[model samples]
Target: MPQKATAKFIVIEGLEGAGKSSAIALVRDFIEKHTGKAPVCTREPGGTPLAEKIRDLVKVADASDPLCDESECLLLYAARAQLVARVIKPALAEGSWVLGDRHNLSSLAYQGGGRGLMPLVSAVSAATLGDFKPDLTLYLDIEPSLGLTRAANRGELDRIEQQELAFFERTRATYLSLAQQDDSIAVIDASQSMAEVHKDILAVLQTKDW
Candidate 1:
């Protein structure tokens, strides 16, 4: 009998409006083509009902009471912890591949870089996830201005998305830096057309051994 496939977790990461949703679809198809198994998909700040509620809490803002940076950072991690434990780990343990729209990298980019909270974010991550990481991370790289422009066209911006341009600039810079240091992470030029970006992503999946 063939050995059971070792489930691999693939993460799609980027700044707001980086085309992550479409990328996830492409990756899902690619995984099914390669593995002959449909990968289970999930999104960060959500997956479970409880986690979704946490997602809402982090995403929506009150007019008079804005969430502090520390509170926002911690809230994001709290939602992530729930999703990882309740969904991701279990799916992987069952020999099912998992595709995450965003993972811990989002926290690193937004909370650590955007909010300048890397120290506290690191502590929270270590405590919550230890060294757990995605097997493959595809970061759709785009200029902050372009990303925000795309997001604006989509509709109302969420609390996080409504942040100033500098916030996303910091986030993008950190993504670039982190991708440079990580073998598992691949950067795609999301400024290109969807066809071009999809082509690039497929090339990475096909060519990279990982």
Candidate 2:
């Protein structure tokens, strides 16, 4: 038989309280059912050792010594570069599926829409990895306020998580716009109950349709 194609890179994206953690588990099981191989799960800014440290560095920022938005954007790209080169690429080469908690789209939504830095985000992504994208992206859409409420209940908010509700609205808008243009993205109504959301996600996964 001819050699099989590499397993796809699947990414899960959403606001803090959009049930991404639980959704990823569902995605993992879905991919395994189809491919008979367990997927590798990785979180942005902290897949590897150095990337984890970067995650910590970017997570907390003092109000007295806040990080510049531009610098914050660059650090995110740096960590992404490390994770992509170190983890994602290798896994795909070995033909194992990869499940990403967040990928390049997060930067576009958060740093671009929220921080008003789309140009910088675009330039960084193009320079670091031109035209590289996940095979499929599942965007869980939810109201910003509801999502924040879920996140707040989880634990203390991170630096970016502490942003005002307006910031998240802009971010969600950007994510929706991107999904509208990309066929590979499946947008799930995350505001629904867990069972409904999971069912929608499974439908997309089984059909391979957005």
What are the per-residue Cα lDDT tens digits for candidate 2 across 169-208? 9999999998999998889999999999999999888786
lDDT: worst 10-residue window of model 1? 1-10
Model 1: per-residue Cα lDDT over 1-210, one tens digit each: 222468889999988888999999999988887777888899988888988988888899987887899998888888889999988999999988899989999998889998999999999999999999999999999999999999999999998999999999999998999899999999999999999999999998888554
What is the C-alpha RMSD, rounded to one decimal, of candidate 1? 1.7
Off by over 4 Å in 1: 1-4
Where does the lowest 10-residue lDDT sum fall in candidate 2? Answer: 1-10
Clashes of each: 0, 0
Which lDDT values do the candidates have, in the order given?
0.90, 0.90
- For each candidate in turn, the TM-score is 0.96, 0.95
